[model samples]
Target: MISAQSLTKRFGSLTAVDAVSFEVGTGGVLGFIGPNGAGKTTTMRMLTGFLPASGGKAVVAGHDVFDEPMQVRRKVGYLPETPPLYRELSIGDYLRFVAEIRGIAARDRARRVGEVMEQVGLSGWERRIVGSLSKGYRQRVGLAQAIMHDPPVLILDEPTSGLDPAQVAGMRDFVRELANDRTVILSTHILSEVELLCPRVVMIAGGKKVADGTLDEVRHRATGGVRYRVELKGEPPDAIAPAVGALPQVDQVKPVPRPPGDGPHDPWDQGFRVLDVRAADDPRTAIARLATEQGWTLRGMERRVPGLEEAFLAIIGAEQ
Candidate 1:
């Protein structure tokens, strides 16, 4: 439903977006994430036809974004980071104005506006002035306008920004509802939101595409291999690391810092030290045998999967 092929945008000496390309299937939700100045908004504006690209092309909802801008605009519903709203207008009036501009039929506009308002939890807020609404409510109003036309694709930048936890959750559910038939590209700094809503993610840094794939795929690629966390007692914390690192199966051993009395039965409290072991193979059996021979008490030995935050950090950090 959406495609970006080497999308490039430049302003004077700086390139805001550089040869970035990705795709989102019909009825799919893709999470776009990056640190500040990573070209997320620049790329999005070009895709929405709000800004022209310096080079390359984008197709949104099957319409060539550059060649057929009008058609692309008609099929895409874009909610920018800061919503375009008229504070003086009442919520209902503002929506009706949008409907008129989007060329919705007068007869169907009322029904459409009502449905969108209810869908975004604004059923009884039609008469309230847009300026008087709280930030969260205003966000809902922005969402309402974006979907009022019932467009086939949505480009939402920070849909849950300024929203409280409850509001954020509600907005997530509403976005899911919108995605039942429409393709969605959501850009946000919130990792948990991406984890909840998007199976695939595209991460960029320094205006370049850094990673793109299913969440697990990216995680594995960034971290390189599986890791195991080991907690052992009856040994000097300082001396145990070198011993573990010498094992044939172990490729890396990173110590997990535990301050005095910090964790459950804190290692320091019971003379145990915890370290994360990344090995060439499953080293549970070898670790157990080694510990038994040394008379060290094993408190915990568990395989650990690198988390999304870890993967995101590793990729973004490396790209920079």
Candidate 2:
């Protein structure tokens, strides 16, 4: 439903976005993420036809963003980082204005406005002046305007910004429902939101595409290899570390230090040592067998996978 091919944007002598490319299939939700000055907003603008790309191409809902700007705009619903609002207008008036400008027929404008208002939790708030609403309410108004036209594709930039915990959850659920039939590009700094809402991620850094893949694939790429957390109680703490490291299935082992006041206090946890084990393949079976032969008590053994935050830091840190 959306495709960017070597999309580049320049401002005078500076290039804001450099040859960034990715794709989102129909009914797909793609997470677009990067740090400050990473050109995430610039890319979104080009895709939505809000800003023209200096080089390359962008297609949205089967329309070329540069050649068919009007068609792309008609099919895309964009909510920028800041909710664009006219402070002087009342909530109902502002949304009605948006509906009219979006080409909603006069006969359907009222129903469209009411449905979007309720979708964004703005029901019965038509009389409230936009200027009088809080920051969270302003965001809701922005979302309502974006969806009022019921476009086939939605490009949301920080859709959950300024929202409280409950509002954030509701926004996530709403986006998930929208993805059942429409394509979505969710751009945000919140990695946890991406994990919950996006199955695939496109990460850019320094205005360049750095990583693009499924969540698990990106995590594996960032970590280099698989790792495990093994806790065991053995005859000697010092011997256990070297013994685990000496195993053919294990490549490296590092002992993890317990926190100052967070040591295990349970009787079952006594004498258990923790170590991070990295290997090409699963080493739990080997470690468990070794513990049994050595008469050591095995507390727990589990595979450890890097979370999105960890993967983000690792990838961005290397790029720098």
Candidate 3:
């Protein structure tokens, strides 16, 4: 488990992280996201004891980050945006070094190193020099080192950065697997990856906490409310908007603009109009019934949940 209570970090007159607070349960991934320069890395550093907080407090695995830094470090596995690696050392030597420093017993170091290497898909890479590996392989090595001691908490900053599409997918799967037993704070710029891996999300912007909740809750808050897409073809295009808007279940309705060059006379256009309807509850059934009663041909109607990217922009854009 992890908790940040108004965690604040400052550099001279500038505040890198301003009283940001959130929590991650004992077992699951919590997506930590923000725009560039939003203080994501700063916050992670403070949580992992790599940087001291200028104000507020953080607790990791039930130990106060400030009071018991060594205990926190022992419980937390940190993978910064750039993996901390010694290029001159081969993968085996580097991980073995990490295992020893992390307090692994000398006799158990080899097995732990091998298990982590295999977990990160670097099983046979023991002899390869870390400096010679590609970006993807380097990331794997970084992850291997982070999990070498099998810490209960993982603070990963941009773990998939610089990885190709296939590598990104692989990393996502591995992170998901890791979340089975550990509490993970996953910070990344990739919103889609967060959507797939993190059921809960905490978004920061302008060095302050902007949003934090279950994925659906944050998206719903960012978008203002739930939405539905309704398409229909009928006699007076003007009547549809007013009729839908007048429905008690509908809070608002806006017509979707026709595509450019889509003329009224075009047969393919079918004189259909699309409306984005916003409401607190499902209105598709009512809308469909109304269309039938009004002799209008209902083309399609479906609920539309805003994507994480859309929600992210809406929240960050508002902060600006």
In candidate 2, where is summed lDDT lowest over 10 consecutive residues? 260-269
Of the two candidates 1 and 2, the one with more favorable TM-score, higher being better, is 1
For model 2, residues 1-320, the per-residue Cα lDDT tens digits are: 89999999999999999999888898878999989789999999999999999999998999999999999999999999999999999999999999999999999999999998988889999999999999889998998988888889999998987889998998899899888888889898889999999999999998999999998889889986678988888887789999999999999998876655666655235768888899988999999999999999898888967789999999999999
Candidate topping TM-score:
3
Candidate 1, residues 68-112: lDDT per residue as tens digits? 999999998999998889999999999999999999999999998
- Ordered by lDDT, highest first, the candidates read 3, 2, 1
Cα error, candidate 2, residue 109 (Å): 1.1
Clash counts for the predictions, in order:
0, 0, 0
Which residue pairs clash in candidate 1? none
TM-score of every model?
0.89, 0.88, 0.92
From the highest TM-score down, the ranking of the candidates is 3, 1, 2
Off by over 4 Å in 3: 233-235, 257-272
